[model samples]
Target: MDGSRTAALLGVVLLVTACGQPAREPGPTGCAGGVPSCAPSTAPPSTAPTTPAPSRPVTVLRGTVQAGVEAGCLVLATDRGRFLLLGGDPTVLREGAEVVVEGATRPGQATTCQEGTPFSVSAARAEPATTR
Candidate 1:
């Protein structure tokens, strides 16, 4: 074959061999196609979810029966702050006694303690001076 033809054939063989060869180590800058810059990461960035704080502070109320009225059988006291208990729960407790009430509270029947407006207890337990 002619010299020029032989050179052309050799060039084609080299190109084909290079394309068929296995990949080499990535270049210094990473896979930015010869550009000295790092390739974009496939992994996503991490983030944390936000949480809400508590609504209102707990109302831990406690106090003594300041007064008791038999009108509707109600007792008034200054619990955590100020409270008025409703009807004397025969199954629960009575007047002039220490009591521990819990749960959402509101005003009860009218009594001398607070005048018809008494603190209501969702639950009440009379604390006796002496255990019976």
Candidate 2:
């Protein structure tokens, strides 16, 4: 046989041998022996329920009430910082009133008033007058 004929016969034999073999099943590592570096996963999924963090405590602020630049916006100027009061007694939250307010500071709360931290007022009272 010529060299070409022998090479053709050898190629046909190799193809036939490869086609007759069964495919290998993947190991527990999800990789066939085709990859030598794969390892099986050992960590298990967690089943415990997760608890939410507690809410923040309410804040008390003492300051003189002042109206914001925008109409209907009330602001309190305290030593701590300025606070925009929301949902308090209209009489107690009047402009120029010296008052003590109890509420939570809602930094994320949206408002038309551009000044001061947004405060949701639960209660408010005017400061008692003092004799000189």
Candidate 3:
């Protein structure tokens, strides 16, 4: 072949060879001497137990138990605010009862009671009646 034809054939051969080769992935940066440990991890995530988050602090509230707009729902009208009482002694949670309750406010909790913030009552006691 003439020199121009030979050069054109060589360039075509090189281009085909390069196209057939697999692509090389970039290595992880900041590795010391390309160590195996320095490569990006492919191992499954850890299954070991982790420390639990801290519990919310309990609150004390004094209020009068009132019937909610919805049936079977009890609410406490306190000085701070009204609380939708959940899971407490039925006797102490009766309507028109004056009570002191210990619990935590659960703002994100879902409930049918439309009024008051949600309060999960841990304990409750009725206030003794006093004569003036």
Top-TM-score structure, candidate number: 3
Question: Cα RMSD (Å) between model 1 and the true structure?
Answer: 19.0
TM-score of each predicted structure versus truth? 0.35, 0.57, 0.62
What TM value does model 3 have? 0.62
lDDT values for all models: 0.53, 0.85, 0.86
User: What lDDT tens digits, residue by residue, belong to model 3 across residues 47-71?
Assistant: 9999999888999999899999999
Residue-level lDDT tens digits of model 2 in 1-132 = 999999999888866765565645676667644343445446676678888887767899999999899999999999999999999999999999999999899999899999899999999999954669
Q: Which ten contiguous residues of candidate 2 have the minimum total lDDT?
A: 32-41
Give the local distance difference test score of model 1. 0.53
Residue 98 CA error for candidate 1 (Å)?
Answer: 1.0
Cα error of candidate 3 at position 106, Å: 0.4
Write the number of the candidate with greater lDDT, choosing between 1 and 3.
3
**How much is 10 displaced in model 1, in angstroms?**
99
